[model samples]
Target: MNKYLWRRIKYFILCIAGLLLALLIWGVIEPYYLDREAVVAEIPLLSPSWQGKKIAVVSDFQIGMWMANTRTVAQSIDRIVAERPAAALIAGDFVYKPGDNLTPELDRVIQLVRPLVVAQIPTYAVLGNHDYGAKAVTEASASDIQRADRIQQALEASGIQVLKNEAIVLPNADRTAENDRLYLVGIGAYLPKQSQPQQAIAQVPSSAARFVLMHNPGSFAELPPGTAPIAVAGHTHGGQIRIPFLPEWSWMSFVEERSSWSWISQIRGDIVRVSGWIPGYGNADNRLYINRGIGFSNLPIRFNCRPELTVFTLQAKT
Candidate 1:
């Protein structure tokens, strides 16, 4: 009888071990094979005159790995441009890693999309935590900083303005005149080593219709009261996994809280909260739009959530 019990226990242990191994592979390795989902969100800001303006939002294209095919990336950009937005906003993470030789390929991708940038629509970008991973990892070498600089130069040359805790006003159709009706503010990646967002938003005229570009959603919590009308971000990558009924602690939880997992709630008081600009304020306001992102991070697979190119139409509230 004792011998029989020992045999049953061994089988149970083996089954548990096998299940664990499968889960590890699914989470870290096989995830790259999953298809990414594309989604669009229409947000209304405080601007009544600027309503009907369309803005394209793209974020977290790690580039070389999941998006290695320049043609694929180009095609995606073409589709986005087809929407004819007044402006394009990139939330950050252009390159996968510092040492990765994605320059030539990235340059090619940029060339395909160059026409869109040079077009009437203004294109703006900000760095993400991965862009400054070398700095975050602590062991990053001098070469890392040099690589980061090179990437920045290339992106700028491509006509995509890279904002590092800075603000730039986008002129309306008049070109020569400053359009106080709308403003674009960019905050550097929320990584502690980078510039602070509080300082970046300060550069913009507070009275204008403020549209903030930030990489991580968490940065919204740091903004001063009544800063911007809407803040855009993409770093959470939509939790990278969206299994129904399961606890969200799977993967993205390791980074920011689950609040970082999706379009977050807007905080409001004397200041405009990130969620305020949404359809509703607090839980109701449409304050922030977090992109699911294009490329894969850490692991190569994506399931349920396909890569997305977000086109937001800003209409005047009736």
Candidate 2:
């Protein structure tokens, strides 16, 4: 009887080990397969002049991270341009962990997305926490100011507009510019010293058709309910790895929560009240869509979850 029990225990241990090995392989290779999703948002206060507009949104490019492919992002840009989107929006984190290679990193990042400028897509962007050297494990550093400046300059040079705590008005062609203006508000990075959401919305008119761009979902809390028609973000990277049906048990969640303490929060108890993983759209007055993002942050492995490219079409409510 004792010998039989020992043999059974050995077999069970071996099975667990084999399963773990298979999962590790899946995680390591999954990131290469990029995924695309379509976002259709209905804005009640949308400008009739700007109806049926298509916008492309991407975020968290973390270019310098291990195993993150720049080519993949360029290909995604190709796809976006093919759709002929009116504008492209980058939520933030153009480069990952610049460390001492700030200039080169920024240059490469710009070069990767230059095709958008060439396509005349009028790309707009907002900085993410990583762009300012702020991570889940650490706060923004003093020296990150230089990194942030270089990123902004590179983006501007590429003809991509950078917005921080500001608003811009794009004239609607169908109607006269006087009354039909599209308001785009780019909020600051959701990090210390740079996070100024109130100032970001200060200039936006309540009546103008508005869409808020942010990198962190945490910033979504600042906007008044029902006032913001749509807000897009990408800090969570779609949880980096989403299991089909089992979200709470996703391998990334166990490690991800540790990297960022505030990963769990209560925003009317609707901020991913799931198993704590699986990134998706949430219903609210603002109607937020958090893109899965294109790059990896702390970990290089991704299983079930792939890099995301979101193409959004804005429809005005009748």
Best by TM-score: 2
Question: How many pairs of residues collide in model 1?
Answer: 27
Best by lDDT: 2
**What stretches of model 1 exceed 4 Å from their correct place?**
1-48, 66-72, 100-102, 118-120, 134-143, 174-180, 245-250, 255-286, 316-318
The worst-scoring run of ten residues by lDDT in candidate 1 lies at 273-282
Give the whole-model CA lDDT for all candidates, comma-separated: 0.62, 0.74
lDDT of 1 at 43: 29
State the lDDT of candidate 2 residue by residue for 1-318, as single tens digits. Answer: 699999999999999999989988988877777777887777776766677888888888888877766767887888888988777899998988867778777777988889899988878999988888876645567678777877898899779999988989853446665557777889877764576667777788777777788887767667666656777878777667666765444444456545442534433433352221223333345667778787886788777777888877889865
Model 1 per-residue lDDT tens digits across residues 1-318: 699999999999999999978765665543333222333333233454466667778777776665343444455577667777778888888766655575664675477668777665678888776666532413434665566667678878878788888887765663433443566788866653464778887876645566778887767667765565467787766656555444232355455444333334443334322211333332223256667676666666544455666666664432
TM-score of each: 0.71, 0.87
The residue-level lDDT of candidate 1 at 175 comes to 43
